[model samples]
Each structure stands twice: as structure tokens, then as C-alpha cells.
Target: MCEHMRPASAFWSFRENISPSALSVTTDGKHTVVGTQNGLIFLNSRGRPLWFNKKIRKVADVSVSTKSGKIAVGSSQKVLYLVNLKGEPIWHRELDSSVIAVSISSRGNLIVVGTDLGKLILFDGKGKKKWEVHLSNSDFPVNSVDITSDGEFILAGTDYSHLYLYDSNGSVLWSKETGSAVLKTCISSNGDYLGYLTSDCKFSFCVKNSRMLWENTFDSQPLWIDMAQTADFVSIGESSNKVNLYNKSGRKVWGFANESSRMGVMASGGGNVILGNKGGIFNYSLEPYLKRLLTGCKRSIIKATEENLDVTESRKIYDVASKNFSNANFSQFLINIHKARNLAREARVIESDSVPSERRLERNEVEEDPIVPQENTEDEMMAKLVQLAEMREKGILSEEEFIMAKSKLLRI
Candidate 1:
């Protein structure tokens, strides 16, 4: 599982006095909500605290609604609290037993709670009980539960080595008996894929139309597991002090090992992962190449600015790139960084030949009187026009910038 390990660095990390008991992240990787013995914590992508509430005693589990940004908190105190992103409580319920697991739908319209009393309960967003299913008569607690994004399906794993899938109406679709107690379960956003872990050190994935897509046996029991919205990525935190990520093909994408135990692991659609234990919560990016590109773009912009180049557009694009990078939106970050780099190159070209230090053009003057090469062959002029077109196509230049660059290149 560690064979394809790639180097990963945390963009940010946060620590609390108590080890995080539960972790949940949104699909965009913008918000991460953590639960500890002290309370519930809402964190931004940069590991900065948005809000914190210490009223919930001994939080056992937490879940976040990806679409609506609602949070559901389950505590060992036999209480469930529904809170907003601002940490203000919307509702609270005292259950018959301690809550072992909890999950909220993507839209925050439904919720499912797993209790130590062997009861799996479903509730509407408004705190109305929809239904409850008794897993076993012998108090085999439900260890883990997950619901589809639309709240149409629910999956639950129990201490009795039983796994059950049910419809929103509380009718069981199917159930399986694992070799051992099921520790964790995850469902893809569309309910088309399922991933689970059993106490037997087995990790399994199955598709909707299939029995099981693949299974892997680990040397140690995996503590927590999560999947991306599209089912393209899965991640696990193990008792072995390692966190491993797997792609849809069941291939290991990367592995991160640390001295401290991983309390939980979560995967987001934006190629971001968060794993933590007693030490702290750590944010890691799967696409480190984009990070390097962003760094290079920043460097290029700095060099262009130092040469007294009119890099106003480049700086604006670079700021957007930095923000996207901080938010773990690697795809948008890549696009913006490339635009910034292209603009920086063009600025360097204009500054190198057009303006001397003493007679540098004002910002408005530069925009009004676009730089035009004093001497250029027909081929050179065509090449410059093509470059401007490329910049326009890539969103490096605005419509006005494109028109101005074109007019300057062809002397129109």
C-alpha cells in the first residue's frame, strides 16, 4: 500500500488541547469541521477558526452538509446538536443512548444517527424522526453510518459484523455479514459506489450494480475511511500511524506516515485530504505539481515587477491564484497561475524594449499608448498577433487588452 508513496506537505495545521474525536469536510475542501472532547470547531481552508462552541460535551462524532454548510454534532453525552457554520445551535436532541456515529445529507435536509443502543434513527432537517431500525436485540451498537447526498439511501455498519443498506423510507435494500465488526462505511455522493472497513483488517469497495469491485487487506486495522464525491478517490487512516489514499482503480496514489496516530481521515473532490490525531489537523494536497506552478508564477511576477513592467493584470491574476491555492481549489489555481505567468511574460517583453528607467510610462499612459515594436518584419508581426490571440483564449488578457494588443501589433 505504501509503494506508490509521494511526498506530501500540509498547507496548514491546527491544534487543540484535546485530540479531535471526529472530522468532516465539505466537497470543495473549503470548510473543515472538527469535534473534540472540548467542543466543536469550524475551520476555514487555511486552518483558521471560523467559530467554536464548547457547549457540546464530549463530541463523539460530527458531520457536515456539503451543499448547505450545516453541521450535525453527536456527543457522548447522549445528545445531538444541529448547528450552523457560525456555531449557533439550531436544534438539539437527547437520544436514548450515546451517539456513536452521525451523518448529514448533502443538502442538510436529512440526518442519520447511529446509537450505542443498537438503534439507527433517521430524522428530517427540522428534527422530526422519520424512522428507526433496531440492528440487533443484543445491544450490538451501530458503529458507522452514511447517507447518500440526496438522502435517498442510508448505509449502516454495526458491531455485530452486519452491514445494511436502506431506503429513505426505512426499508432495507440489502444487508451483508462481514467477517468481523464493520468499523466504518462511506457512500459516494450518488449512491453508486460504497466503501467500508471491517475489524478483520479488510477494506472493500463495491459498485451499485456489482457485488464488490475490489478488496484489500491491511497489516493493521484502519481506523477511519472516506471517499470523494465522485468515488474517484478514497482515503484511510490506520492504527499503524499511516494515511493512504487510493484511486478508483484500487491503486495507492500516495501514503503519508507520521509518529502520531491519525484520529480520522477525509477526502475532498478538490484533491485535498485532512488527517489528524492528538498532535493536530493537517491539510495535504494530492496535486503538488500545481503548488510548484503557483510558486513559479509568483516568482516570475516578482521579477517582472522589479524591472518596472506594467504588471497590474499579472498581479491581479496572481492574487486570484493564491486565493484558489489556499482554498485547495487546485484546478482553478492552475488556470489562474498559467494566466498570470503568460501575462508576466508579455509584460517582460514590453518593459525590456519599450521603456527606459527614467522615462517609464505612467499606468494610464501605458494603457492608452500600447507598446508597438519600432522595427518588425511581416512574420514578426504575425507572430505577435498570434501570441495576443493565445493570451486572449487562455483568459490572460481582457477583451480590451486583447483589442489593444491586437491594434498595437498590427498598427491598426
Candidate 2:
């Protein structure tokens, strides 16, 4: 059996002040954008706060294009804002009805939005309206919508349970009915596949031929569907704590069902899945064919420490060390483990106690790379470990190289 590595889950690298119920999150496995009651928060890859704005309110939904750097925020007040990474709105427009759903194309040229009043509108990246239409000549608010990477095909579901595929020119390609209210829907990155869930628990997928490929019912209704650019996996975030994973052929591969009812922040990566919630974010490798890890943080203690960011996510991995220390028979190893845990907890307190000036931080802003580290910390050991893990994930450090470095750290 492969040896257990460090804990698979940790709080995102830094910062938090999120109000759980009012937050909407979206990620492309790299950058994450969060929509709150009065503002939107953007984060770099390591979860460092980059910028936020207090003007946008009641964000109904948000979308991020992985290939393109554009971010879209749809508000319930009949407006949508197209913004860049700097949190500056490129443009904002008022729609015909309250914006219920919004999506951005990969090329960042087209955006599609569904209204609560049965209207669908398409726009260019500059927030200029291209076309608008009311579905079925009546009020059947569009529920969910997605655009292909090339802006060619648009998939939208409405309150009347109708699904329509429209071309960029506002021409209908085809339409179908789910026999119940459509809850959520999404299109694959290449625009070849479309999948959706309905009010009756029906989960279905279709191919480019406009033919139904497969359909099934779920015990728990899905709240959202996520399909990333490179992976063939489709993630179904259900109302239950479960997030189900399925292949393109509609086969069940695996799932993660920990924490709350929603998989609030998600991104798929090389044979693995990353999830974030009110508690924090975690990175897990699916071992077996693809499944993984071992490190527990007595759930009650974690729940209790939820508000204490200084001790929670950032110090979580040390909980594993805590467990290991208790059973260790060697005195020297136990001393080191105890010392390491203390240092880790101290690191958390130091991190949480400090705040960066938003204006001053812009000078450190990365215009071209979001994932690069901008600063260093006082803890060299932890910093080195984080660097090693990043290198391993990026394939800069081989498994053997990582194991060698990790073993040395554990010895300390």
C-alpha cells in the first residue's frame, strides 16, 4: 500500500470573513470569485484576498471562465457586471427582468443570462446586448444557462422545465421539456455535452447530436452541475451534503459527502477534486483507481473552532501530528511533534492577527500570474513544505523527491 502523505485537506492558505448563507462561490480550479450580500471577493490560487467591492449587492449568481480571465456577476436587481481580475467593472447593464442566472463563454466574447420573467438575453464581453427574447411568449423565467467555449451553442433551462439550444445569432437549434421545473444545467467545455437536473430528481445528459444520451433519477436533488475544461468528470452538487461525480457516459465514479448541503466552491484538477465551504477548503486526491488520504480533525473540535481562523484550517494538518504524537513510543519524536504543532498553531494566530492594506497590496498584484507567491512567511519549515506540495502537484517535484523532503520535516 502507498504510504499516507500529509493531510489532504487544509483551510485555503489564508483569510476569511464570509457570511455563509448569503455567499455564492465559483472557481475554475485555479481562481475563485465569491459573491456576498454587499460585495464580491476575488482570491488568488492560494486563497489570498486580492480585492473586493462593496457596491455590488445581492448577487444572484456568478460565473468564471477558465480559459479567459473574465468574471461575471449577476445580481437579483436586474443588472449584470462584467469585470476583470482587478475588481473593476468593464461594464454594467440593466436587463428586462431580475437576473436569475448568468454564464460566460470561454473565449470571453459572449455572455448568456436567464431572467426570472421568462426572458433570455445574450451580450458581448463588453456588456453590450446582442439579442433578447422572451421564452414561449409568456413568463417562464429562465432557470439556468451555459455557453460553449466558442460561444456557438447556448443551453438554457426555464421555470417551465423547457431547455433550449440557441446559436450565437439567437436562432433556436432545438428544445426539450423535463416534465418538471428545471433546477440546474451545464454544458461541457467543448460544447459537445449538456446535462441538467429537474425538480423531480431527474438527472440527464445529452450529446452534440441533440439526442438524449442517458437519464436517471436522484434521491437528493442536485443544486448545481460543474464541468471543467480538461476533465471528463461532471460534478453534481446536491442539496444533500453529497457531491456526486460521473463520467461522460453517465457512469458513477465517486463522490465526496462531507460538511454542508452545498459544495459552495469547487474546481476539478488532474484526477482529483478540490472543495470549499463555510468550514474551509480542502484538496483531496481520489485514490483506488483515483481515491485518497487520512487525517482526521475530531469533527466536534473542528466545528467549535470554525470561527477561530487562527486555529482552524491553517493548523488542521497538525491535528494529524497530534494524533501521531499521542501514540508515539519514542520520546524524541514526541517532543518534535509537540513542538511542531505549537509552531503551527502560533503561525495561524500570527496570520489571522495581521491585515494587509488593500491599497498597498495592489502593488504586489500579479497582472499575468494569479498563482505565484508574492511574499514569504517567518516559518521556513511550513513554507518549504507548502512549496514542496505545490511542486508535487505541478509535477516539478517527483514523488520520491517529495517523500524524501517530507520525511525530513516529520523527523523535525
Clashes of 2: 6
Task: Report the alpha-carbon TM-score of model 1 versus the true structure.
Answer: 0.69
| Best-fitting candidate, scored by lDDT | 1
**How many backbone clashes can be found in candidate 1?**
0
**Across residues 201-254, which tens digit of lDDT does each residue of candidate 1 receive?**
999887653367567898877888888666655878765367776654455555
Candidate 1 lDDT score relative to the true structure? 0.75
Which regions in candidate 2 have their CA more than 4 angstroms from the true location? 1-17, 20-28, 263-412
Give each model's whole-structure lDDT. Answer: 0.75, 0.60
Q: 1-412 in candidate 2: lDDT tens per residue?
A: 1112222333353335564222223333445677766788776656676898778888877877755677888888889998877788888998768888888887689999989998889999877889998887779888888787789988889889788889899999988877998878777656777887789988877765566656668776676666644324576766535666654445454565544535443443323344545545443334321211112122222422563535554345445445543443122222333344334333333444333122112211221112223333323344345444544564645677567666755565
